[model samples]
Target: MPLKACKMFSNPTSAPKAPSRYCQKTLHLLENFKTLVVMGDEPDREILKMVARTTIRTKLYEALADQLTDIVVNSVLCIRKPEEAIDLFMVEIMHMRHKFDVEGLVLDHGSRHPDMKRRAENCFILTCNVSLEYEKRIFLLKCRAEGGNGCSLKASGR
Candidate 1:
């Protein structure tokens, strides 16, 4: 029932010398979970699309076909503002949990915003920074969006 928020490197351009260690670590970390839920920002649309089409989606289907019975993998980019984006992402996560019974949530750029801290307050938090040279940072929030009559869910459902 604990939600984990991890802060890591965001801007990839600064680290020209080496590839993103955060990304590699995050991918490896995701493999340990049974269900995978991914949330990415507008900037990460292409990367998310590649992941959805190639590996994660396929592997999830192969391992937990029954669990994803009604799940829909949406790869559309529509939102313009940061707040709206997070709201939509959370709603999607909730929907996947309630309608499709998803066990994992993978948020790419969705967790980078500072506003997410308020939304993910109840969950566990882990802050990690690779270097200070990077001007921007992104976060990864992982939590089980439990379905029920919870206030947050009720509010978002509306």
Candidate 2:
């Protein structure tokens, strides 16, 4: 048995006009098996760069605003910080969930793991992080904030 796959580029103008010979051959070979084709907008370099600096929680909320039912936010409290603030926040969140009859609570942990995938099958788990390739961006921002040139900071490996 053979399957043929057909992909429809949402933006026809963005689709490559002529694929390479290797691509044509691969497509020809796959013409007899079941194939699933997914189409999406090409990644934007500027958006990708911005995402690298943004936190996972902010990105998830922005992307899934309509679908999100409940969210649990965690914060660290020191002795100088008011414990009642966190308690009140949790109480308010619980009240909101109860009033709205929220369906699911998504936990954003900022990193991925094997257990995360398993837990995601049962509940929503958000895993997103600033990739190592973008570490330079963070460093540059810190350097700028400290009134130092980013290039010099990178050269010094600080």
Candidate 3:
């Protein structure tokens, strides 16, 4: 008499694709991304509306698309930091918009600087915490060196 034994193994590489009914070629898995979702006072259904059709409801938040997690927001901060304030309370500094990247510099409460038009087609923007006069002095010197008109010949404050 003889006894037979066999072992079976499954392939890890052949794992099931996500959203089986959806696209199998491009699985929008967040395996490599670092994400954080901040729950505001809004109900899940309301928040879900802001989410894009391409994103899974269980996954990333709309503002946090492209790994730009706006962070796990606190309710009061959410009230204070929405894109637009209620008609009663309007303040620029506290109102954060989803249009811009969180890591990018916002520059002076988003107020327009001097020598800039209400609508500019092409322009350069420079920002610093120092006094505008200091920046003006630097700009004046550079402009003079480049033979550009309308700039002071000297650097202020020796």
Compared with the true structure, the alpha-carbon lDDT of candidate 3 equals: 0.40
- Evaluated with TM-score, which candidate comes out highest? 1
Sorting all predicted structures by TM-score, with the top scorer first, yields 1, 2, 3
Q: Which candidate is the best by lDDT?
A: 1
Full-model lDDT for every candidate: 0.43, 0.38, 0.40
Better of 1 and 3 by lDDT: 1
TM-score of decoy 1? 0.19
**Model 1 off-target regions past 4 Å?**
1-42, 54-56, 59-75, 80-158
Error of 1 at 21 (Å): 21
Q: Which ten residues in a row have the lowest lDDT in candidate 1?
A: 1-10
Residue 3, model 2: Cα distance from true site in angstroms: 18
lDDT of 3 by residue, 1-158 (tens): 01111112223345443334233222344333534545454435334333432342235454344333223222223445345432324423556555764533244555566776788777776765653321223423535446456555665566
- Per-prediction backbone clash count: 9, 4, 2
For model 2, residues 35-133, the per-residue Cα lDDT tens digits are: 443223332334433333354434445454323312222211211133232232433222233344333453434456656453445566565665433
- Order by lDDT, highest first: 1, 3, 2
Candidate 2 Cα outliers beyond 4 Å, as residue runs: 1-19, 35-105, 109-129, 132-158
Which tens-of-lDDT digit does each residue in 52-127 have in candidate 1?
5554444444435333322323423432354444343444532224444333444443336555655554576666
How many times do residue backbones clash in model 3?
Answer: 2
**Model 2 misses residue 52 by how many Å?**
25
Clashing pairs in 1: 3-123, 3-124, 37-104, 37-105, 37-106, 38-106, 39-106, 39-107, 39-108
Model 2 RMSD vs true structure: 21.9
Residue 98 local lDDT, model 3 = 58
